[model samples]
Each structure stands twice: as C-alpha cells, then as structure tokens.
Target: MTTTVVTHQPGIIAQSQVVVQVTERDWSTSLFGCFEDIGSCLCGWLCYPCFACQVATNAGEHCITPCCVPGAMIALRLKVRARLNIQGSLCNDCLVDTFCGPCSACQMHREINNSSNGHLQ
Candidate 1:
C-alpha cells in the first residue's frame, strides 16, 4: 500500500523551519509622561470627554466608541498595545485606565501622533 500526504490545506512547517521573534516593546512614552506632550495634556486636562473621543479616533476606533461602548477605553488600550507590539496585558490596561485615565489618554494620543504609518488617517 502507498500513502500520500497533502501539505497545502492547512499548511505545514518543516522540522527545520526557523522562526524569528522580536523582543516585546513598551509604549514610546511613559504612562505618566503627560507633560511630554503638551497639546495632549492640555486636551486631557481641559476637555476630558472630548479628549477621550480624540484618543479613540487616534487609535483608529470610532470617535464615539468610548462613550457608547462599555470598557471601550480598556479595549482601545489593548488594541493600541497589540498593534504597536507594546508589552502589556488586558488587566494592566484596565487598571491603568481606571486609575490614570487622563494620563493614559495622553499617552495614546502621543503614540499615535508619533507613529509613522497611516493607521489613524
């Protein structure tokens, strides 16, 4: 009897295959570095709710997501961290959002602004 194997459907990796991995990265700016971006800080301090909307928009999310969707801010944080390869967990995102919400928003805004891609545009 003869048996044949198909390697196309699900794709298979050979035993000798090599995988490359890059070290996990942290956010470009510190979580508490609100002053690092003066414009974002002013926005966060002056009009918080609107600032949140802007942050959402910056993260390529709907402008109203933070207001309409519960836990949207935390979700946005996770998405941003994941998209940028930033090292973080959902629990940490939730905690940071709950405690230092304004600072977090500023950080996200700065991150998006500093990014070169058109992920937000």
Candidate 2:
C-alpha cells in the first residue's frame, strides 16, 4: 500500500506583495476655460437649453437627458471625469455644478466635442 503525507503550516500565513498603480489624469481644459472653444461658449450662453441638449446628445445620452435626470449636471460631470481618467469626486462635481453650471457645461461640451470616442469622451 502506498501512503501519502500532507504538511500544513498552522501558524504562518502567506501574503501577496502585488501593488496596483493607477494614474490620475487631468482634464484637457480648465473648468472655466471657455475661450478655448468659441462655438461651445456661444452655444452655452446664447441658447442654454439647446446647448444642454447638444452636450447631452454628444455624451451619448438623450438630448433631453439634462431635463429628465435629477442632478444631471453633477452626474454627467462625474461620468465625464471617470471616462477621461480625470481625478475628482462627486462632492466636487456637485459643488462645481452648483456654482459654475454654465461654465462646466461649456467645458464638458468642448471636451465631448474634442473626444475621439463616442459620448465617453
């Protein structure tokens, strides 16, 4: 008959030394850098509703997404930042949306317009 012996370490534990590194990126443009894109600025200020719809549409959301979704601006900001690898938090998004709604919209509009991909840009 063949016998098998098993060894067990009851007092020792194995740990992994693997570390994951993530790069936090910044937005291509500043939040209030509206002058960088004339078209977006004009669209945002002259016809705010139309501008909002256009921005939402470009972001792969319904044209009226801003109108339908509660706190849509903040959520959109979070989504855009996440997609672009930009570093920020929901609280920051909310504060920016609350105080600089138009500028934020214009910035996002420019960002989406310049993004290479659909909506996620």
Largest lDDT belongs to which candidate? 1
lDDT of 1 by residue, 7-107 (tens): 57666654687799967787889987877878779889889889999889877888999989998988988888777778988899999999988888888
Q: Best-fitting candidate, measured by TM-score?
A: 1
Query: Model 2: which residue pairs collide?
Result: none
Off by over 4 Å in 1: 1-18, 117-121
Q: Candidate 1 clashing pairs? A: none
Model 2 residue 118 distance off true place after TM-score fit, in angstroms: 6.1
lDDT of every predicted structure (CA atoms)? 0.84, 0.81
- Once fitted onto the true fold, the runs of candidate 2 whose alpha carbons sit more than 4 angstroms away are 1-20
